[model samples]
Target: MTTLFHNLAAWVVAWAHTPYASVALALLAFAESSFFPIPPDVLLISLALIQPRHSFAYAIVCTAFSVLGGMVGYAIGRYGGRPLLERFMSSAKIHAVESYYRRYDVWAVGLAGFTPIPYKVFTISAGTFLLDFKRFILASFVGRGGRFFLVAALFYFFGEPIADFVNKSLNMLSVAFAALLVGGFALIHRLSKRYGQGSARPHSERIREP
Candidate 1:
């Protein structure tokens, strides 16, 4: 898998200079938001690094396609994914996902869109939970757009230095970002549990002995 990824990354890097770069970026962004294991950020950053002038445009394209792909993932979950989830994912994983979604809903989707949290899981969960499409699109747009644009903006302003820093420290950054993502989801889960359950609970002053 590592070898395949390295080769694929090399291919994408080579294609960055081609006119097909934009098309490739869109496809990659789309796939990444759905079931593809690789993140589109690699292609976006490589292209931006090679052609700094068009970085923001590249970011916009990446964001748009990514959100669209997320919608597709949502549809999958909403339409015919629940049974598959039960068949494929572990009980523990399902409980974690349900708890998080039951707690956060759209905010959970947004954070997953931006962070390093295997976005495909949240995309599918959003559908299973019957979340609103409009709100899903809006949250995905904000989160994914902010993430790609932030990277593009940094490359636009800092250029090679930023690239060098990322190349050298990517593993560390990935770990840090994952930690933050998990913590954010946990907080959202807590808040959702508190409010959702509180409203559902009845006020009682009398206790009967069993």
Candidate 2:
């Protein structure tokens, strides 16, 4: 697994110099949403560091393709069902994902998207569990967009001086960013409750675990 990850990282980095770098990024974003193991950030971060001015553009491409790819993942779950999901992920893992859906509903997608969690798991599980399609898309859009844009913004604004820091601390940066997002969400939920705006989510949204 480590060897394959290193090889894939190298392959993704090599594309940064080519004319098709953005295309590769888009493809990586797409594939990773479903089947690919490596995240598009490997390429996004590489390309952005080399060409900071185009960071947001790269982020837009990554987000768009990732959401499109997520739809395909949803289709996989909708059509392929539990049997197909079992082939890619273990039953225990699948059940855990389903449990998240039961608890957080569509927001589970947002959490998975913004964090280091394997998005493919939530994407496929969203389908197998028959989550609302529109909500799934919305959550994916926000979560994926937030993450890619946040990564891009750093290199885009800070330039070369921060390159080493970003490279060394990217994982920690992502974790901190995700924690902030989660905190913001919790705060909003709390505010809504305090203001009496916290209406109960529809029961259907909380699909029971299979």
Candidate 3:
């Protein structure tokens, strides 16, 4: 599994040298938000290193499609994920996440989107927990945009040194960031089960329980 991801990462990185890298970056951003593991940062960083002048454009493409993909992940959780989680996961535990979501919906999604905490899980779980869709989308835009554009900015100003620094330390930094949050993704392990109950409905129609 480790080797497979390494190969996949290499393959994604290779696309940066191609004329199709822009397309690959867009596709990669969209995929990573939902199903793919290796984040678009790999491609975004590589592309920026190749042509720092175009870095901002690549960031725009990355942020936009990633949010779109997050919406799809939300649907997957809303319609499918909650049912699967219920078979083995405890209601008491999932309800803990429900309460968490009810209280910190945007912060949860936003932080997940920015950090290495697997935003896909939170995106799907947001639907499973019946979080407000508009807020989810807004937070996705902010967090994903912030992450990708920060990469763009680094290369734009810092030039070559940032290329090596960001490439090597991005994961370490993300881990450090995650460490600051008490429980972080651990708090989300018990994340999704509510939609199986009375929570499944149009995102716009859903309301918090009193």
Q: Which is the leading candidate under lDDT?
A: 2
Taking all chains together, each candidate's TM-score versus the true structure is: 0.77, 0.88, 0.76
| Clash total of candidate 1 | 0
lDDT of 3 at 18: 90
lDDT for each residue of candidate 3 in 37-71, tens digit (9 for 90 to 100): 99999899988888888899999999999999999
lDDT for residue 62 in candidate 1, whole number 0-100: 96
Q: How close is candidate 2 to the true structure, as a TM-score?
A: 0.88
Better of 2 and 3 by lDDT: 2
Off by over 4 Å in 3: 85-100, 172-210
Candidate 1 residue-wise lDDT, 57-159, digit = tens: 9999999999989988888888876886666568798789888777767877876777777777888778888888899889899778867887788789988
Residue-wise lDDT of candidate 2 within 58-78, one digit each (tens)? 999999999999999999999
User: Model 3: which residue pairs collide?
Assistant: none
**Lowest-sum lDDT 10-residue window in model 3:** 189-198
Best by TM-score: 2
Question: How many clashes (backbone N, Cα, C below 3 Å) per candidate?
Answer: 0, 0, 0
